[model samples]
Target: MLNRLFLPSIFALLIYGFWVSAEFKVIAAGVAVFLMGMVYLEKGFKLYTGGLLENILKKTTSTLFKSVSFGLATTSLLQSSSLVSVIVISFLSAGLIGLETAVGIIFGANLGSTAGAWLLAVFGLKIDLSSYAMPMLVFGLLLNTRAAKPLKGMGYILIGVAFLFLGIHYMKEGFDKFQSSIDLSAFHIDGIYGILVYTFLGAAATVIMQSTNALMVLVFSALAVGQLDYVNSLAIVIGSNIGTTVTTVIGAIGANAQGKRLAAAHLLFNVVTAIVGVVALNPLMVTVDEIATLFGIHPHDYTLKLAIFHSLFNIIGIALFIPFIKLLVKWLKSLFNDSYSKEPLNLAKIDESSMERAIYLNPAVLSYPDAAMRALTKESGRLYRNTLELICYGIYFSGEQLRNTDNLSELAENWEKEEQPWSIKGLYIRHIKGIYADIIHFAGALEGNLPRQQAQELFALKVACRNFVQAIKHVKHIYKNMGKYIESENDEIRHQYNQLRLCLASVLKLVDILGVRRNYNHIQEHAAQLKLELHEQDQQTYSTLNKLIRSEQVDSYMASSLLNDSAHVHDACTNLIDGAVIMITRDREEYREYDLAGFTPAAQKTSS
Candidate 1:
């Protein structure tokens, strides 16, 4: 288990070592020092989930501006865009903030990343910080051995700082050997091709290393040796911005609709920023050079220029795009639809009537919410299969017969009408709700240092399950009443049944999101829509109850029961939407007022 868990971290370390060079080493060491300082400044994210930070931000002139600033600070310290993105996603899921607010925070993360580049530039220039790095490492290890609280924190900080510098030292050693032997200056470049090649290389390196800081070091190495110039490196930094999105894109693979949508949005933000950098490169470079000259520095090294251009271009990109954020949201919605298929259709399989024999069907019992979500996700997928089979078998209740009809409508109808064993459905529904609660529990068990959005998604899953239960009950009730007075020729039994079915199906679709897809937005919207449908059905139920009572068709006791069930369904749907909304909303006050905190499940009773 330890090996499995640490494998990724080991890979990250190996990659860092492989790609880092001597010029880059100075940059890396500086980044480590700065990161240590940031950890001290924030006191190691004491009130994480961004509450304290969010509060500080809200007091600023603009909430959006504040969020961006916070995002930058947080990401700079964390050094992992994936970690930051997960936090943003979690915040949206937890109902601590809105999607727009989260988006702004993410934008800030891009800017915050320039901190790494600046650190690299600073260290590259100083070239003497290495002497103290070893001392810091030795003292840090000693302090860590003691149990004193403050010393321990400082010790951990020192250790991180030491490793970072050590990594940089090794990296610089690697670069030094190449600089002495290699003659990059002899291989001069034509202007356009030079810029394009180096720029593309920067982007490629960032994508491969998954760190802009690491990529900046590579550029610094080239600058340290008179190989690549500043303007070209800046171009590469610009391209790195675009390339960073590839990780988020890969993370979204096989995710539900919402995850894919957010991934696309992240890609758009980076690519658009890259374009902005391209357009303003010459102007930005001149401005930086003018400043460097004022400070009596030649700015001969293009590495600093790359850093300057990176910060300016990102700021400019944010300035140009911030106001039109809503437009971007709208564009994202238009570009991707829920029905958009990400996977190829599986055609070669068992016959339709042998669905139970299909690999998709299994007898495994679900013990956790994740397990239940997995189960329900598989079950929900049958909706499409069932519908297609119905069409293929000519199973419509209408009089008209199609040219391709083999009169399989009877077969389809029987299959549809066959009452799914109550125990089976009950176990499934129980698992659904169980898994929902488990998700929340698992999130809560996690270290609180995690972002707020992460916690709220777990809660949202719980809400979604509650809503699913109501939908299932409503459908079962309708099925029970179908052959009675509710099913008369003139009655709208079929319509009511259809409403229940749609709500239930929607709930099932949502289960896929919670299962493993991690698409919070897609599940959230669908949850809200399902609730609205359930609400409408409640009204219809009331209307039906009044008519039944007027004609004495349904006795008082039966009418009362039906009304209760209808109301329960309505409430269930409302709860699901509320839970999802809390997951998505930015305003903590809104969720607090709803008191969803009351909805949390009790800890599982352990066996004696």
Candidate 2:
């Protein structure tokens, strides 16, 4: 059993068992089971946060209203607002939108999400589209086998559209039959508790369905068929808001601090809004009723009014909270803060929470690397400052902080055990891997829409950063393993470390060129000169390895490992600068520079 197949089989079997136990009809049970499966699938799809945002932007580029329609339609087609919200959240986290701008988009997303509801309300109640679903699915299956790109895309669209209508049809039929036989006519309950129960139901449904759109459609169909009322529907809507957070929460679980933050923000927004909604239920519901009546609509007209209310609540919430975003953010920080954590967090990860936090940080940094670098420098400084504070606590206030001499002894033992040279070596290995990956990504991005000169400059900076990662790691390694390693015998390690520092210095000089705007010629000249210097340094580092090893003062493994690490660092730096050169020299018809001698043939390939 393949890993993916095993879970779906188990889920199907479990759902079959549940449907039989729940006394649900076969069709209703099938729909319920499929929805359960959909939730898991949508959650998996949400991992590509960046690509999702790009698609959202692509769909929304024409006009704001059209964009909203496109968003709604696309989400309806996809059957996942959590997916759409995820894209929106990523854009927000990436600083693609300001707080005020994001407020509207978030509102738009809420509106767009209602498309599925409208579809279900109209089609589920008035028409039977389930008959076409099988044909559409079959057609899609055929199209998927075609070699053409357009055919494949159409195939996907057909399949998605078919599944969506099929799901709606199944849900409607289930509820209609369930309603006719089982009397769920009315239950007199307290307003707040009723709202809470309905909201919880909505949340649970959305979570199980893995889609707010699905729940919205269910609510719409249920109301259209008169199985549920406005108050109950409204409560479910609020619950759907809470349940939607589950996708992002799951997305951020193993992700970095930034991812966690975005997920947290999403959870916070839904939970807070739901709570406030519960508190304001009576007045808000009345207001909705009054507004609907004023528009010459019946109080019982659930579809139009439901959509209106969903839009209204989110819009009002966004408006009311926009000005107090900073305060809300501060509150979130206080709420989430833990005194024991050592790692710093990226607030952008709380992307789904609000635009204020998500839409202003990452894009700013990625768009303007200089600004990002400055910000990173400041952050690095802060990290070091915190480290210094900890060091002070260990030094001056050691006795007081430790509480007892035995405790101090325990702390020392723990430090010796936990912070060993092996751990430092592991960090070094991880950093080296990251440097290579970053360089490759930088090269690929340079080959795209960026101007030749700009590409080169970026390439130079990437090279410098790679060198910096190596040099910093070497410093950590030396500081940790200094007592054990023989400096006289380990001259190879010392010389390699020195060469690494020199490479860093060259990178710093090249980075200076990248700090401000410059034309292609200037960027090219700087990159070429820097590459030459780096090549020379690489040669020097490699040349000294034999001399240092012949002395036999240190073990061969350590000496050879140090040399190999140096070579890796050298390659990373050289590749970065070379990538810049390719970007800069690419546009020229007959360029004079081709410094391919330093690179291995495998590494010489560039996009341009």
lDDT (10s digit) by residue, model 1, range 1-608: 87577669756875675476454444445445544544432332332323344454355315777778877887787665655665454333333345566677778888988887788777843475457678987887887777655676677666666655555554555555656655555555557677667667767767766666666666666666666656676778888887788776765564434445667777888888887667766777788888677766655756666677778888888897798988877776677674323242222221222112111111111112232233233433332232222221211221112222343333223333322233324433323333444434443444242334433433444454454444434444444443232333434444443343344334433533343454544554555466666767778778877987799766686666566545654554454444334334322332323224655422101110
Assess every candidate by TM-score: 0.54, 0.59
lDDT of 2: 0.52
TM-score of 1: 0.54
Worst 10 residues of 2 by lDDT: 350-359
Please provide, for model 2 over 1-608, each residue's C-alpha lDDT reduced to its tens digit, 9 standing for 90 to 100: 57679679758977875565442453455465446435433433332222344545555644545544654555655556666555544444433433333333444555566665555544555777878778987987798678654576566666666666677777667777767665454752457778878888889877776778767767776777777777888889988988888886775443334444556655766677777777887778788788888888776678878876776676565556556756655554465443223342222121222111111223222333333332233322232222222221212222122322333333432432122222334433432343344344534543453334444434443443444444444444334333233233455564454445345434433432353343555665576577677777667765666666676654677666666655655554554454334333433433322333432212233422
* Superposed model 1: Cα runs more than 4 Å off: 1-62, 93-95, 139-156, 254-258, 294-296, 338-608
The CA lDDT of each predicted structure is 0.53, 0.52
